[model samples]
Target: MRRLRRLLLLLTCLAIAVPPVAVYSDAVAQERVQRRTVLDLLFGGFGFGRRAQQQPNYQQRQQQHRPQTRSEKPKTKKKVPPAIAVPEPVVVAKLPDARKVLVVGDFIASGIGDGLTEAFTEMPGVAIEARTNGSSGLVRQDYYNWQTELPALIDEIKPAVVVLSLGANDRQMMTIGGSKEKFRSEAWSKEYEQRVAALSSFVLEKKVPLMWVGMPAFQTTSMTADMSAFNTIYRGTVEKTGGTFVDIWDGFVDESGKFVVTGSDINGQQVRLRGSDGVSMTKAGKRKMAFYVEKEIRRILGDAMTIGQPQGGEAVSNLVVTTPTDAADIVRTQPISLTDPALDGGTVLLGGSALDKGSGRSPRDKMIQKGEFAAAPEGRVDDFRLDKRPQPIDPQKATN
Candidate 1:
């Protein structure tokens, strides 16, 4: 019945849509969800195989991956797909024995720790480590000096793969130490952004493989725009720095350019993902996102997954235990997927499965503007910062 409904909806999407890019409906906010996972979720183990058994709580399957740099960084843009916009460090030979996977980010990344652990635990030659702080972002005007932490962590772990997600808490009005400064002001915002860019540059210097997750497809345009701007910078810096830039905006978005969270998740439950409060990922959201990461990792190192097993690629451990205590919590699982649609190259809210857009007139959609804007490392510049930007938009450039 649910599958039939999805089919009907897709057909409706094709028939009555004013334009593929300009879809808007109150019903879009309400739909069923499914539980899903592309691979296994093991915390730590030696073997790899799917149980191929159904659990009590059944759900459907789904999932979603980065950006930008400087010399000290190499010139990345080559006037084409291979070209980049920033400079990056050189890639060095990694240990053929096996590689260490290190993850870094703010709260959203932290929340999904268990799922990530499970996803990578059983791989023969792979060891996974997760480091995350709740209140961190790419240090700039609005939030904490998240940049300072990354360098130190990188030095210590020396990880071959870095999965990073943050920058939500950092969105705020900036105020200077002694004076009133803000992030909304161009001067302050650019300054704060420069610091953020600097940190991205530093990451590029290490030449370590980094995956910078973009915010998921958002329900509101205001928050969505902010994230989009951030993504521009992230991609520019990460790609320029010789790191992989996964354009996640397309996978989770609807033909109308909004979040489609409802009919998306596995269990057909109302979605709590894509954009948690328009800024975070729910339990379902994070695990789904992790699957995308797993897919990319396996593709990059297929043969090396098992140590010394030249051709027996079957030893590959795709899913590990992402939830620690829930080892026996036989819930449904699915891939980390999102439509990631780029509606006229706009920003995307992360975490929603491919079916859910997670858009509506919730508290977040109002755009809390009671706070002051300034020129300090906060979004404190009030002169130019309006109380709000645009509202929900018509998707003039949405694609299926």
Candidate 2:
């Protein structure tokens, strides 16, 4: 029993000594050491005497205990290309006597003006003056009367050509003889026709060539149908009043005659022509619409629409007057008939020469004079000769 007690005391002493030594070793190594109990030491628990398994490295312990995060690749920025610059059209300076084209009407007319300006931008002899009220129409004289305003504009601008593009906003009620007439009714149509004629006649009286640009098809079916009817009325009235009607229906429609948002441009390239609202025009649409007007204007203006002129010379009219030194010095040639044989450098007409009885006339001459058909060429399908023998091929011709 004494030996057992001594053994117990020795174990207790060993346990106490082992802890202090472990603490000293931990301190020397600068590491955390797990303290062991005396019972564990006596029972020979794991790592009882060996330096408490050197606590894992501080950095390694931190890394092991830290939460895991998703690995993400570094983000890189994409390179964007620089925008290309578009060149603006160069407009030449207009002469003091440059002819003016007065464009008047509603919003569509304003778009036409914009397009015409671009169209004639380079012409020094032509100028465009657009006088438009966006919401004005023939029906709303109370709002704005074109008849009253047109005379003043003509006198003020003295345009060489008067271009009218109206009726987009004229689909509402109209007042006639102090009575409101519903749109498109018989009475309304008469009044509208009269108004168109009156406006056109006023321009005609002023001696300005009137160009009534007809309405184009709209996006809405009803609006397109209304425009078609309006165009018809415009064509009839304007033509009756000696004004030129420009039909632009085909430009804004597809092959099936339906309204299109995109269509061929002035350059024949496919492009967006109309706006989202379906009433207004995009830039391309404006340009295309102007194309129809431009043709008529150019045709009417003729030589007045020449682009560039001699830089430092005085502007002169096309007519040239020259004084001859003497009347006798003037040389003149007699006018000859278009059918004169001299025109072809021949004194005799075709088959004019008399043929000898021995020299018979050709089949062509007989066919021309007697309405007889010339013989068909040999080997031709029309050649109905009884002989059907195959001709031998020429070796040289075949080789060639």
Candidate 3:
């Protein structure tokens, strides 16, 4: 009886569970078929789930959506620019064993030469000779005829380059063909230009490059004007003769194009450039003058560098090109003595050191006490002495 009851209860429980499970399974299967049918309608029939019907051609749909022109227009191709060719690098030749530079001019050129000398001091295998005649120029050939003497000078100096600066003394009467012509006159200009051309051409004729440096502004406006005129003539002549003309007028002047006595040095320090007389230059001024010419030389030489050999072709063994040491070491390094008497400016008017001599009397004081108006060794004759009557010689002495 107990076993029959247990079997009947178990059959009743299964009947209830089976109906719910079968219903869920049938609903799930229907939902799956509906989803597949929707997918087939939206996408192509060859996608996920089973296919319900064939899909429309995607290519046809795209053709329908896309608008077409009446007739397919011909397309134009875009143009492209051609590539630019690059230039080859320039190869500069190295400098030779020894190179000599000749610097000749008036006082200004003398200063330039000094500056160049200092500039090239450390540059090995390079030598410079400053053959400047301070009181000489293109004018006054009787004083020192550069046009007639330049050839002999070149031969003697044997320089690789010639630098000429003149015309500072040319603003006077020019004697030509047994006649005197005032400065800036047609005859004077012609003769002056001829002399300049002759001098400049001689350098070129010797197979050397010529650099004719131009003059700077002077303290005197009239003098400066004359220098400007001279520079114009120099520029024209130099260019025509195939020589380099270095203009340094701009360097020595201020912003307003006026002359400046004190200006910036090469190192850019403010110092006195023009001297007290306003005609010559200071040490720094001279260096700055050379700076312009040096630039042109380096440009033409194609970056020529310093070497280890001397100008005489001797190898540097014991000498060091440069050194950094104490101030005392520098003082002792040079060959010259600091106390040399020949270099002493003592006894030079207004330049010597005033010795006290323990008498508390300065050299200037002694001069004032003595009422000395003229310098010694070349004293000027006093008016009183000139006023004296000529001494009559004895007749006997005159006969003897």
lDDT of 2 by residue, 1-400 (tens): 9999999999999898874433356455554455678877788665554444444455578988887766544557888888888887776899888899999999999999999999888778889999999999999999999999989999999999999999999999999999998989999999999999999998998889999999988988998999999999999999998999999999999999899999899999999999999888999999998999988777767677654666565433332233476999786554445677457555533445643455377877878888888778888999897976767999999999
Better of 2 and 3 by lDDT: 2
Runs in model 2 lying further than 4 Å from the true structure? 1-83, 307-377, 380-400
The TM-score between candidate 1 and the true structure equals 0.47
| lDDT tens readout by residue for model 3, 1-400 | 9999999999999898885544467545533534345656687554443323322444556878998786766777878788788986443332455577889989888988988877767665567788988889877888888877888888887888888899787778978888889989998999889888888888898899999999999999999999999999999998899898999999899999999999998889999999999898998899999998877665444323335433665333323233445666653322333577335443323334544447776667877998655333323454445335556789999899
Query: Order of all candidates by lDDT, from best down to worst?
Result: 2, 3, 1
Q: After superposition, how far is residue 330 of candidate 3 from its true place, in Å?
A: 46
Candidate closer to the true structure by lDDT (higher is better), 1 or 2: 2
Model 3, residue 167: distance off in Å is 1.2
Off by over 4 Å in 3: 1-97, 302-304, 309-400
TM-scores, each model vs. reference: 0.47, 0.61, 0.53
Q: Pick the candidate with the highest TM-score.
A: 2
lDDT of 3: 0.77
Clashes of each: 111, 0, 0
Please state every model's RMSD to the true fold in angstroms. Answer: 41.9, 14.0, 30.4
Error of 3 at 366 (Å): 87
Relative to the true structure, candidate 2 reaches a TM of 0.61
Clashing pairs in 2: none
